[model samples]
Target: MSSAKYHQIKDHILTQIRSGQWQEFQRVPSENQLAQQFAVSRMTARRALSELTDAGILTRTQGLGSFVASFKSQSSLLEIRNIADEVRERNHSYSCAPVTLESIDAVAPIAIALGVEPGEQVYHSVLVHFENDAPLQVEERFVNPELAPNYLQQDFHTLTPHEYLSQVAPLTEARHTVEAITPNQQMCTWLNLYNEEPCLQVIRRTWSQRGIVSFARLVSPGSKYRLGGHLTFTKRS
Candidate 1:
């Protein structure tokens, strides 16, 4: 079958979801059904579904079927995760808008956090993340250029800062401080939160073999996101 056949199938499915013809948790047609309806091979239909599932438009259950994804988004408090991955795994589309990326002179606070001289230049970035076209989080970061020199040149729309840094400087130690606060207006605008809405913020600092790699402030609006973690205890031998 032509590549256009699979793309046509994907576009149909997306249109159905977007138009509310297929609601969240509603089961999408099986590959066999789609193949028959589209007059294409099952392989083509399967490709469409698999691509949609990988893109987080649909969630599939083994032995069951694929369903339109729901709105809830979640992440782990105890682990450092690529927010893009976190969004997709929850059956939600992930997108990012890069608001700022530049080399800026570090102020006293940024300098202290990065363990650099107060006037040293640091790579800074601000990004707003989206889940299913709705704003989810705002990530503001400062990178130590010595650790990741190309931080400023990265295309954040293609890959998140977390993903890029993990590649260049594998994490050795990470510190997280999570708190609830009322975000400033600019942050509220970034996350699409109302002025009075509360936010969950995590102040994260990561280290590599040499020294600190980055300092970041990750903030999510209270109503639209969640953070959790799980651990299994093992008896020591």
Candidate 2:
């Protein structure tokens, strides 16, 4: 079969899945049925389904036929929002204190997150965000130098790192992991917390069209901060 025929078959299946005609975990037509409908050989139909399965759009079982893959749940914390804007929107005064901003050699962990080699120079910044004179968040971010060449030159106090990076390289994707931890001595001092105080930590990695944009560790005193969002769940039809 011609490559175009296989792709056409793939596109047809994709259109059905994308349009919600085929719901998550809903069984798809077998290769024989697809071949008969598309007037193609089983190999051609199988190629289409195999490609979709490889791309995470479909799942196939040993005895069962292909089915639409379930979409992964996403947290609103992964959504790109300016921290300064969030504070201001709460009807409180917002301020940022730039604690550290410099070009540094990426450590192993930083390099792995940024998809760069260790010892490569990367832009690093630490800023404390305040709401109504109270420290609300401590942001420690490592930026890919290729994506934001002059990241260190920006005045984070005036324009937040998020704001600046958004202008330079529009975010394409972001991944976040949240956890609770006891604040370290330095973190406590920065956030004005007592010893053994728990904090909510958000570790986020973001990407742009160019490549990995930044990896950030944002910490907030648990007593003063909470993360909440709503997600709609859809049932298979």
Q: In candidate 1, what are the lDDT values of residues 1-237, reduced to their tens digit?
A: 548888889878877866679998999999999999999998999989976664445778889999986533223248777999988999989999999999999764466567787689999999999999899999889999999999988899989999999999988777665667788788877877657798898777788888888888888988887778778779999
Local distance difference test, per candidate?
0.82, 0.82
Q: C-alpha displacement of 139 in model 1, angstroms?
A: 0.1
Q: Which runs of model 1 end up more than 4 angstroms from their true locations?
A: 1-77, 234-237
RMSD of each: 20.6, 14.7
Clash count for each candidate, listed in order shown: 0, 0
Which residue window of length 10 is worst by lDDT in model 2?
Answer: 70-79
TM-scores, all candidates, are: 0.65, 0.66
Superposed by TM-score, candidate 2 places the C-alpha of residue 207 at a distance from the truth, in angstroms, of 0.7
